[model samples]
Target: MSTHLLSRHSHRPRASLSLLTRGAAITPAITLERGRAHEACGPARRSFALWLAASTQGPVLWITPQWQPVTLNPDGMMDFADPARFLFVAAPRREDQLWAIEEALRSGAAPLVVADLEEPPAMTPVRRLHLAAEQGGSLGVAPLALLLTPGSGGAAGIESRWHMSPAHQGRQRIWQLDRLRARTQPPACWRLQQKAPRSGLQLCPAPQADLPSEGPHLRATQQ
Candidate 1:
């Protein structure tokens, strides 16, 4: 067989997954590269992870500390992703939780693996996850591992870092999404809104500060 024909017949996995599609000419869709580890922080990090899972087709492996009292509410997940599609792995220790995440990515058994950690992990483990994901790609599908950290996540050596927080109004479903850091993109913020339950997500640039260019310069006189 010719080299060209052989290449054409080969299976090619998607390089990235899109979370939010482009809105008009504002910006291109939000995407996370496959076979890499990314970070999501802030108050709505879990929701952010769900958005990513919604865009992919496969079982989702969610790892959280078994001791943590908080649990995912299926009723609340309906709007984002089907709860049935998730497989929960509760690790009793922090180290165990990360270990599970690394193994899951290396196996390529699930396209998405989420690790809910109380604190950000150091660069060492993050690098391991990245390598694991890369190895998994060769096995079959390239898994995307998401690290959910509290507050402003500071996970090192990640492909990207995203922060999301609720910014809702009376009845409007709104959230502020910020791309804090990325390997190839600059920092940017956006207002994400879901007009209706099934309407889908919409994005708009975050509103600029309303303050004047120069705050009234106060003149002080000797008293």
Candidate 2:
């Protein structure tokens, strides 16, 4: 059998196991009493933490030019309103910051870590981050989807890269998300409409129905 097929098959059983584990983690009574109902839905119904927080749950460890860690969340919130859940550490330069990031990835406490520096990361660094995430069971969001702003370098180690430009439609802000690179998928774009107050985001006009049966693939990829 092909590698992809093997991966798909292996993923099926693991998905079910993952659901059971996550469900058990969330609620023990539900897993025991309503286990049949849970099993009936299969593994598809479990809420994946990474899936739940896509773009929103960033205790984003962003590396600055000075190598300082400037953490930012999805809503552009930064630094300690809540100290226990979020942390922002500053380093002096890119190299130092990357080292700190690797350490954090190894720690696995932070859900998402982002590096924003001037130079593109070496493949080794990228691979290291990937390994750390896989080992630690966390997700890594890299050079893509991160607003590099003025001094950001070219893409490296990123599975997908996006360039976002903000435009206005009347009073609303329409952010265009353009894909720079996406492996194993076609380059695609979307216009995100941001709602106020809670700042909830949704894809405008809905995505193409023919794409995939899974919930928004892009969101999954980003997480």
Candidate 3:
């Protein structure tokens, strides 16, 4: 093929949505490509989702199962984003939850769409979400779809997968964040903490020995 044709076929650089505060000394800003679906698992998955919501501007569309026993506490969400900024979509069934997520992504109205899922969905639905996000991006804003799964997330075809859990030591509030899977990044770990209330978050390397094993808890603290 001619050089011109090759250039036309080459992949273009993609836009990314920042997922965390950029105050970490050695760590670069962790971001997910816009118009893609990502996964967050582990004990603090809800907290991870809240962190993502805090990083973005505009309204957030959060979809969860209506029958789920526990719901997001407004007081708990205050540390991240304003609870009033979130528009909740409570789906009555599993399939409805996925459908709501798909529609929200396709609409491109909200910059972030979060699905608090008990478990991860299959590859086919994930692909559909990717397509919907791409279409939404073309129409207006490029929405980022996040799946909050319980335990060790095993969602297939996701742009990336992250696991976070509490690593508190006495009075200090800390969490261990692991980039378990990514297409372009290798596995890595970090210790995330805030110096004070309403202060910027800090990230530092976590010692291998300090990393905690996956716990059975699904609920995350408001911190």
Candidate 4:
């Protein structure tokens, strides 16, 4: 019975291996998936975006609300990326911020675009972004889009969602990358170690052995 079932299942098609991030063969491709998006939040969002920026080519378009309580310092960002490659747009209102993100994705001039938000945008705006990214917008590859929110992100209708928190130990600046939501993969976690003096992003698979007998507490991941 098992052999027969296996034979029947072997006919199904499989997705190709295409990765945009540093590691993980199981992570989904960040290309041409309409009506889906990626999200990350918490204190590690800036460093995560900056780490992503280094892996891609072309300019990065950054959008934020003018009234946003926090600011992006070019001097600090230059430590991970070239500040000159970033085009900052301050949207005076929430609607304008969504519009800016939509237009930037539709233009495809940037290889990556990061939007810093006080809270998650509505589902409609998220759908528009997914559509624009899938259409390719006259570029060879669809531009990657990331939304940064405060607290654990709860972006509606996204392809994948992640939560990052600082877990520094001694002189090392370490971070925990939690894969909150994904369509095809199970929840995962990683330890990101930032090597000093420009060694770049270093990723390590966070061991699952430390999880409790009941399993890892998931409350912190999907928030």
TM-score of each: 0.83, 0.55, 0.85, 0.75
Deviation of model 4 at 184, angstroms:
2.3
Candidate 1 RMSD to the correct structure: 10.9
Per-residue CA lDDT of model 3 for 1-223, tens digit only, reads 6455433466776788765565544444477788999999987888778878888889999898887776777766776678888998889899999999999999999999999999989999999999999988996669999999988999999989999887766445577888899887788777877556445467644532333532222334332
Over 1-223, each residue of candidate 1 has an lDDT whose tens digit, in order, gives: 6455444466664598777743433464577899999999987888888888888888999998887767777767877878899999989899999999999999999999999899999999999999999988996769999999988999999999999877765556777888999997789888887776534578744542221111111122332
Winner by lDDT: 1
Itemize residue pairs with steric clashes in candidate 2.
66-92, 66-93, 67-91, 67-92, 67-93, 68-90, 68-91, 69-90
lDDT of 2: 0.38
Estimate candidate 4's alpha-carbon lDDT, on a 0 to 1 scale.
0.67
- lDDT for each candidate structure: 0.81, 0.38, 0.80, 0.67
Once superposed on the true structure, which residue ranges of model 2 sit more than 4 Å away at CA?
A: 1-9, 12-60, 67-85, 138-153, 205-223
Which runs in model 4 stand beyond 4 Å of their true positions? 1-36, 204-223
Which is the leading candidate under TM-score?
Answer: 3
Candidate 2 C-alpha lDDT tens digits along 50-161: 1222333445344444532232333332111222344546567667876876766666555445444445566677666655555544343221112142222344555544
Task: Give candidate 2's root-mean-square deviation (CA, Å).
Answer: 14.0
lDDT of 4 by residue, 43-123 (tens): 677777776776666798989888765566665666566778888898999899888888888877887888988899778
Ranking of all candidate structures by their TM-score, best first = 3, 1, 4, 2
lDDT score, residue 134, model 4? 61
